[model samples]
Target: MSTEQTSPAPTLAEDDVDLIETTSDASLERTQRRSDAIEREIGEDPTRFRILTGDRPTGNLHLGHYFGSLLNRVRLQDAGVETWVLVADYQVITDRDGVGPIRERVLSLVADYLAVGIDPQRSTIFTHSAVPALNQLMLPFLSVVTDSELRRNPTVKSELEATGDRAMSGLMLTYPVHQAADILFCKANLVPVGKDQLPHLEQARVIARRFDERYGRAGDGSRPVFPRPEALLSNAPNVLGTDGQKMSKSRGNAIELGMDADTTAKLLKRAVTDADRHITYDPVLRPEVSNLVLLTALASGRRPEDVAAEIGDGGAATLKKAAIEAVNDMLAPVRARRAELAADEGYLLDVLRRGNEHANAVAEATLSEVRQAMHMVY
Candidate 1:
């Protein structure tokens, strides 16, 4: 396999910061307005709300994955929305890495989903590779998106830079088209994503609109086959790693979802902090310490400033100890659940099989409609 340097993944906080700094005030306001409109729509009808979300099965999920999107997914499922969770194994090769460990990673990802409360009864969880029609959908989607548009995608740019901008495979470049298919396959109208990912969703919308203009309309001039999916932003705070960078599996800074108390403690003890023993929550001046405070706040359900105030004069040792306790307390149940789920390989496979069946049915129905719309059904 060809080698490339992938950029270290950004923490949720970093993603927000980078976007906030770069986005114009008018653009931010526009997004906020759109969000408010979506919020109102969210309350109108639960049955009409269809959400699509998932992770690449490239590695184990960590706390960054937990707070950022996982929790929101569970909430959506419980709230009676038609939720679809995808294991995007097809996307893992965007970095040109071979598929040797993808099978194990896919199973581990399923185990993590179960452990984190993603009920198969509520959400359809399927592997991307299992849905043949989804890949077929990508072929038409690619027609609407131009090469320059793909080149301009921020996520693609970031991934390319991460891999030292080398080994720029065609698969890597067209992954966004595949993603568009993922969202449209289920006719998902709501996409849960970070601010940084809004562009990808925008591209999906563009593709949907183009497809509709060309072949999505009905004979009676009714609704289009696919809805222009909207971005459902999360208010969750970014969870940085011990190094104060984005918590990532590749970076080795992440505390994995299945880590035990002992492992959590060891990791926290070495988390980057200041030389001074004083504890404060000034992220600007003391990012490393502030990162710890933020994690504790999320874990213990306390405010970061309040946690800082409570730990006044306690120094780095006291702060780290508190973080350790809070993180372990938060993850202990998750760890136990993961262990139980992992022990039952047969059960995990069954869940995947069931989800795949459900997803394939939906994707096939949509693809049939697409083919009919384009006069290819015969």
Candidate 2:
């Protein structure tokens, strides 16, 4: 299911005409070198880094989440890097109206994390709204960046475009700054993000640098307040949905992490595949079939070409069955654990409570330092 693909050109504002250029091969080489170095560094001394990565409680997480970033989070946590997973509850409304069953969603998200081996004991799982100090950092953070910088942010621009026709909120525009607060609050030095999110990380770096330049001096010695976090770019595969489009809960093409075996099989039955009797892993020629093959490979920890060759002449039915079996088998334990955790709502809430308390303590310390650095401690 592998194919040669070019990175999508970032959707930039009209003013960012120069920034719209495609990624050069040399730039990619440098990124790859940096990624390799980071991996080695993490291996040598995992304690030297703290990672902050999270999701908005938009809906139930799906396989796209599992393979994309969740697994990486688990790996980093297991490797002993200090991990902080924030449930971006407040950011959910940055674009949408009304919080819809937010409490349930947040709890469910925690359950998902726990089910997938994100040890609550090791990783702090907190919510955005509960950490007031973290959000408060956004005030000073915003002061460092300008309106044009926010508007030019690629992630914000893409989100705005997604909201199509809806008037952008002030919160939505300052989303990147809020993200910076999320990272810097805990002083997380590493952030797991995809290439598309590089711009947002860059904005966070800019804010950190500007804030330090403006307010990071107390005496003759310079004391930088915030660390400019680097992006630990993900190497996860681009997993498409059942319909051959991007896997999304909104599109109803996602296989949710909470779905039982029967439900997952039923959904896979509807997966779009070509009428060709022969099965082959030609992503460029047969994207839909190749997507299914990739899913099965990812699920079973096998290679896509091997999965494709195994079902060479069996056609779509065999492919779908293999995918169903592989996915269901992999998720069986996760589903079981999720259901068990879901039954104990109090436990989930307690996890959030503890995480929030810890996050607040850390944020308050950071904010206090920020104030002291800016000579606002009086």
Candidate 3:
């Protein structure tokens, strides 16, 4: 296990300072307005949009994954928008030493997706390694970005901090560029992201714009080879772990989607909470208890305050029971479906095989266009 060290914040250059200012309250308000308009437009004409979003197959997805992203992916696919979900397998090695049972984890991830109503038929689910042409775009994408830009990316900086004393790998340093390739390879115009991830999307947009200006036939009749993708900011509440911190698989605090009801109940029993016998929703004052209330609200489709009021004077035991019941009830169907899918490994492989074939076809076409634009088709 890597020990996390607290290092002093790095000094920001002038350009980095400007980049940080973009996330200020006023800028976030503007982003929210744009997101609202996009939501309305999506409802009006879903076919005009294409969304690319996904997860790295590091482990079984937990509640954080469900509420934060998977639910929204299902909604978009069901809304008639073209959706592509990438299993970022190669990215697993960016921070870690080796891929531990990557094949098993990938299949398990597919099971989780299927369990949660991600219709593979409606959405394309493919792995990063399966699409060679997609990775090939990395060369051009990397060329458009500067070393300072890559290092200045907030996501990269945080990821580096998380790795402790391990030297940042070249792969890790260029993670953002590879992500740009993932988005551009499919010509995806919309990407779902949280506030912290906005910088990564911006980097992708920069690469797209720079590549278009440097190599694209702008003055002529042809359109740019890649679209500058915009962020579709998520409105999901940040769900904390049982330990009163952000839920994460590595932290061992996450309640995985694959856990059975009994297992879930057992985990909730061990969850931390306040000594107060009365329950109330005060995230600032009573974060641990409030986190449980929040989870219950998300699971039951009720408000957090309402749940807390109902559980008033019920104490920690009652609070844990409510969370366990609500969460298990919500996840019952997902767990059932996951079990059935896990039993059929052949079916899972077939899903990946078909998705890979489709991804390859799309990536090859995009690469051909890129080669022609750069005058490297020969």
Candidate 4:
């Protein structure tokens, strides 16, 4: 029901006026690059239906997570999508060194999800590993998706170096098929994604079409069994780590979403800053300072320019301290929520189990239709 217009243009708080305009132009060019407005209507349906959004259960969520993708998921769920947040536990191993962290970290990742206000009530929180039949759908879905489609997935190309496994594992090579299962398993109609994930979303839509073409036509067949799940492309930026590198656990630069006060302070104290000392927010000209300022602004719900002004009268040390305080203040209520959840082990488990049950109900509904379409059922 929200009929809000898309904002003027997407820009980082610290983006210069010119850089912001150029970025907008580049976006318009991409839109013109493809001659279709059909794609614009992809995830805009207002039937008040299903959404699937998730994170790789690699590590604890963090500040970067909040402003990056998680915030939008929160918004969507609050806006009444039957939102499902998958704890992609098994997918965490695709590029990782080993499974040692899986057992401990996966649970903690769930805690992070809960702590960050991804309510178990509003959003069903279930693991990728929890649903067996959905994973099984991967092989069959893979049979229909093209090898060219596999290669063209940008995530594949980017992960190639990270995994160091040029010899494609069936698991890594056809991750899109798995993703299609993630969506189609629940008859999901909406998927929130960053720009990097558009190809996979396209493949999901294509796979759904191909399945219908191949299996949906019979003596009485006239309709596709699956709906084309649409992408809710994220408007959030790729949040930088404290070191101004990509915010990742492997990089050892990410500020975790569930850090204790002392640890959070220690991390920010060591965070990178500019040498010139004057406090301003210009990401292109001053990445380090701008990142800190933006983080502070995002966490405090202040505009970047306001943060710039707040720091303008002060020295670099004062700015850093204020930014740190702002971030800490933001983390306070979230941390409190987490602590309350963590203390009540039974309540947390009940939430997870209840959510899993509901999710299974959804999955089973879709699986039944899939079975009927494939003629595997009476």
Point to the candidate with the largest TM-score: 3
Candidate 1 residue-wise lDDT, 1-378, digit = tens: 222212232344533443343246676567667876876776677787899999888788999999888888888787788889999988888775687598888999999999999999888999988999989988888876667668767877877788783678888899778888999989999888767777777778777877776554534448788988877777888888999998988888899998778888898899999897778898889999999999999999999999999999999999999999998999889999999999999999999999999999998888888876666755
Task: Give the range where candidate 3 is weakest over 10 consecutive residues by summed lDDT.
Answer: 1-10
Taking the tens digit of each residue's C-alpha lDDT, what string does model 2 give over 1-378?
A: 222222232233522432332144565566667877999999999999999999999999999999999999999999999999999999999888888999889999999999999998899999999999999998888776778768777768787788799889999999988999999899899999888877777777777766776566334436678887887889999889999999999999999999989999999999999989899998999999999999999999999999999999999999999999999999999999999999999999899999999999998998888877766765
Predicted structure 1, TM vs. truth: 0.91
User: lDDT tens digits, residues 93-208, model 3?
Assistant: 98889999999999999999989999989999999999999999999888777787788788788877887897889999999999999999999999999988888887787778
Task: Quote the positional error of residue 44 for candidate 2 in Å.
Answer: 0.7
- After superposition, the stretches of candidate 3 with alpha carbons farther than 4 Å from their true spots are 1-21, 163-165, 218-221
Comparing candidate 1 with candidate 3, which one achieves the higher TM-score?
3
In order of appearance, the predictions have TM-scores of 0.91, 0.92, 0.93, 0.84
Q: Please identify which of the two predictions, 3 or 4, would achieve the higher lDDT against the true structure.
A: 3
RMSD of each: 8.1, 8.0, 7.4, 9.6
Candidate 1, run of 10 with poorest lDDT: 1-10
Candidate 1: segments with Cα more than 4 A from true spot:
1-24, 160-165, 216-221
Off by over 4 Å in 2: 1-26, 162-165, 218-221
- Residue 112 error, candidate 1, Å: 1.1
Candidate 2 RMSD to the real structure: 8.0
- Model 4 misplacement above 4 A: 1-47, 162-166, 217-220
